[model samples]
Target: MTSETYPVDATNRVKRRHDRGRYDHATVHALLDAAALCHVAYVVDGQPYCTPTLFWREGTHLYWHGSSASRMLRNQSDGQPACLTVTHLDSLVLARCGFNHSADYRSVMAFGRARLVEEPGETARALTMMVDRFFPGRTATLRPSTGQEIKATAVVVMEIERASAKIRAKGVADDEEDYALPIYAERLPMRTLIGAPEPCPRLAGDVARPENLAAYREGRALEDALADAYRTAYP
Candidate 1:
């Protein structure tokens, strides 16, 4: 989408290479849905710290969990400004020249305030959402979260006031003169590799694969079928 179609507010500015930027809900949500981890940055006593954490998205909001005693969560619960970034590396473009080397990636940056969700039921729901975000139908099959487990966890909800997405996906761009140079150059791809599924040692030798584990059996991309499996098995 063009920048005019996806307007940016005071908080989210489309800086540098504005042509490659997007602010629409569809662009941002797509990147968020495909990602599992996010790097959260915040200021503490004039210093900045970026902590990596597991995250999930619900419409225009993002939820992340931390220990109840974590300093980041404690400060965020006090109503501090936070910046969350989610990124997916698609591939690496190895050019003939070092300066031309680059990576194909999609990323989203959100700016907003974070607050704690202390309610018992809401906290449990957030945890379940987190689980479903990664492995669909896992929460239902696993044992329910205990009360002590809920109490020990801290959930932070961030309203996406301003956000933008950046994407770079293409083959190597070589200068007209460089094309005649004697060098091998191309895009060497990288992807998530899944190995053969190994069963637990305690399972019976004759036990067959469960329906929920069929995705792994076919060697499919985790992001492609996770949500659908969750909806089918849990609904």
Candidate 2:
């Protein structure tokens, strides 16, 4: 089904106007694809626990891995609802007053039932997808995941049926009366910065920077462009 056809249920706790919310698959997947980290919230004994984890997408399913003994995974596998959220902070907007300070960001929150992937091949593929999602080409350079490694890890799959994307971006809004206030108002943009690439101390002689590092040279502003470059260069 197309993203427009994906069902959207009211899952946002804040409920800021419904118009800003979106249910399309494109909106949901785009937010997931832009970042590698997600905050997973689940309930255990009536209390909520939110843990940050690395995640990846395949078709409409979201998969994350954890230690086989992880409490979060165990709880979800035992039958509980979970919420996964992915967010990218693009900038910070500062207005004349503290109340006007805000962040420009894109975030997606998904509610789904989590299941444990018990099949050996499926588990291995999930792990491989996770690695490649983060490092792109590193999967080929690293040793293959062994049976022991798979056994030591746990993979959870969440089928997203109800989800929404909320975004607040750029500029400042001030009350008409407050606009004349003496306080200065302006947006202090924020961005990701990539430091010079560091190499392993054990590596011999002057090793050149890897092609993967090229996209991160300037951080977030160039992230989209870098991603295109990475896909072109690596794929």
Candidate 3:
């Protein structure tokens, strides 16, 4: 992390379309922090498995939670090699030829060893951090988790040993002959938008929305809201 870029090896090097690969920490960490979900791939008994879960980043580390009995968590309880990946689809590239069509996206792949957080205090803090990652300072307004609840939950942390970001945010990339054809070709932009908030009907009438949710307003882009949450939570 002291260096601007991570050391690239066979494990983290982007082989295909190497030009699209980014080895800098800024690009990789930005993509990881902006997304709320990630797919963690690990091998258990020589079988490969990829589990999708909500994840958050703290500097060079990534954390996620799941059921204590989860196979993925149990297998990763001890130090085990894992790959965490996050992606954001930016647009749909429509090319005249099917072979040339591809969606534009920003993605990061992080390689590391994952281990369960067994310490009670650290587990509580990690869970709280996960919640506050999307809603900054919201955990303070919530009640503490009971011992039984903590026992049933599992928190895993991975120190990012190496990471690389791959981005393709440009318009359509079609062959020269295909572009001149009559068929239409363009990039259809896409985005995740935040919908208006809905309160529970059983809630007390006097209860008002918390200040932490100010960034999650209607018509806001999901990525932008998350970015705001990250800034507020870290700052």
Candidate 4:
């Protein structure tokens, strides 16, 4: 079956080279779930602020958390408008001409109004969801959060109103004349690789890492593990 899609408005539409824009829900959510860090922008007291925080995606909603006293969390939890973005730099496009140089990336921009999740129970669950989504099958393996710990943190969930994703995975593109020049041109691919899991010196007995983490090891493909998270069982 075909994937569902989201609407694009003047605010979220990728107009400037619109050909790169995609409104499909799969594309949008994939970009969000592939990365845990998202930069959320909001206006507080007529001044704009963008804060990079760990984020989680579920269905069409995005969630983030921070200290209860954080200004970004405070402002956003009060129903302030927010624009959240996640990006992945896939490669460096080495074009024959400097003017044609561009990076290959996957990115998504989502517009929404943030809502504070006040109920302690729900906030706690959301935190668990974030952990499960990122670390995957690891939440139950560790110690659970305490009541006091939950109370000191704040969580905000944004129901996406409009979202769009842009992806560029092409090889070097240079002007016809520039391509004729004897200049090096190619796409240097990149991925975030992980090193062997280091154990704490004071650690106890045997430690078992998650299976998904194996894909992130050095010489392995990190994208596969990340993409798997984006397609997790939770919606």
Candidate 5:
């Protein structure tokens, strides 16, 4: 069985609405994997910055990349403390009163110190892993990245020192007495959808759709489709 909880420190503690807090690794990873983008918060020269970037998980580490000259990447590469957050909005929840309105979402907040991944071999591998995580078997079909391209990029990873997930997946909630209100109270569910792929105008041959992308074209949720494709890919 998978572990039920992750160690939470003062930084990772969820003080408000504690009922929605989940400390398990599964919950954190689930929220992280479901989203492709994350906002990384850190301090630079005592001024705070929250830079949005694309990130991916590999084993126990979370990795993100950027231009080597990026200030955010340069600051964090030296082991600066940071917080990474991934959130997916699930719905607009309407309640009987404006004060009780809320949104359904799955979100994870992780605290950690960053590490610069400088080794050429590891850097290359990290790039490949991210590609495969988002598009299974895609790395094999594409040409290997040259050393120059790799050198131009900076890959930094974090150990995920402590993390917690806050989830609100249910419908609207309101006070008992408010249920008698005359206004219509409802929940509007939301989703991130993938549309059919458009082919390139400079096409050479008849390129068939990859099985993984085909599922996405059929309207499967991005995370669910990726999971299904990866499971079948290895088996």
Candidate 6:
């Protein structure tokens, strides 16, 4: 059975302002599912690198893909240690003092060993899941990937060993004395809003937008749309 919370070890223990840290699977998974982009940090030949890419979660594992010739993918193909992180900025807090000014955000850092998914079947399935992750039911509307296309794509899966989530979603946290100052203090919420879908100009007029993408309509919050897509795909 999987533990309800990830173990708090030296690798994942929160040191500063530990009250903001969360170890529960619910918190970690929710944050991961709400975002599509992540940074994978790894060391190669004494050099540190962090590559930003699109990723998806499946149970305890995180999956990402890139060109088979990608240096980042090749380096991580041999079960190399990696740290994946995701951050979602929620608001900008303008405090009375410069030191007190901080942004609200939800972030997660997961440690794992990334290895290439070499199996043909598994790689194909992972790719399909990646597409359906944001456009549920749309995969079935498309043609199957050619063998060459599949071979050119490299899929990597990392089983999260330990993870920690830190979130600050509250308002301005100014000092008592600073709060009493005349300086203005407020929280400006931030949002990633979707815009109207622009269909391909060369497409036939008969082609209409798929119903599965209705959740991604204009003015919708990106995080909310992604979360909805995840639930629609998995639920």
Candidate 1's C-alpha runs over 4 A off are 1-11, 203-209, 226-235
Worst 10 residues of 1 by lDDT: 226-235
Model 4 lDDT at residue 85: 95
What C-alpha lDDT does candidate 3 achieve relative to the native structure? 0.90
RMSD (Cα, Å) for all candidates, in order, is: 3.4, 2.9, 1.1, 2.5, 2.3, 1.1
Cα lDDT tens digits, model 5, 45-104, are 899999999888754578988888898898987799999998888999999888989999
Compared with the true structure, all predictions reach lDDT values of 0.78, 0.75, 0.90, 0.81, 0.81, 0.91
Better of 2 and 4 by TM-score: 4
Query: Candidate 1 residues 1-235, lDDT tens each?
Result: 2343335876677677777788888788777776667999999999999999988777677899989889889889866899999877788887778888888888999988999987878887888877776666678877787878877889999988789999888779777788889988888666554568888889857977667666654466655564454355345
Give the winner by lDDT.
Answer: 6
Mind giving the per-residue lDDT tens digits that candidate 2 earns over 1-235? 4456357544643388555676778777767776667899998988889999988776678889999899888888844799999777877787888887888778898888898988878977777767766566667876687878778899999888678888877579777788898888777666555566567888768866668655665444444643444354335
TM-scores for the candidates: 0.85, 0.86, 0.97, 0.90, 0.91, 0.97
Error of 5 at 20 (Å): 0.4
What count of clashes does model 1 give?
0
Candidate 3 weakest ten by summed lDDT: 170-179
**Candidate numbers, best lDDT first, in rank order:** 6, 3, 4, 5, 1, 2
Kindly provide the TM-score of model 3 when superposed on the true structure, using C-alpha atoms: 0.97
Candidate with the larger TM-score of 4 and 5: 5
Instruction: Locate the minimum summed-lDDT window of 10 residues in model 2.
Output: 225-234
Which of the two candidates, 4 or 5, achieves a greater lDDT against the reference? 4
TM-score-best of 3 and 4: 3
Which lDDT tens digits does candidate 3 get at residues 26-49?
Answer: 888888878888999999999999
Off by over 4 Å in 5: 1-4, 229-235
Model 5: lDDT equals: 0.81
Better of 1 and 6 by TM-score: 6
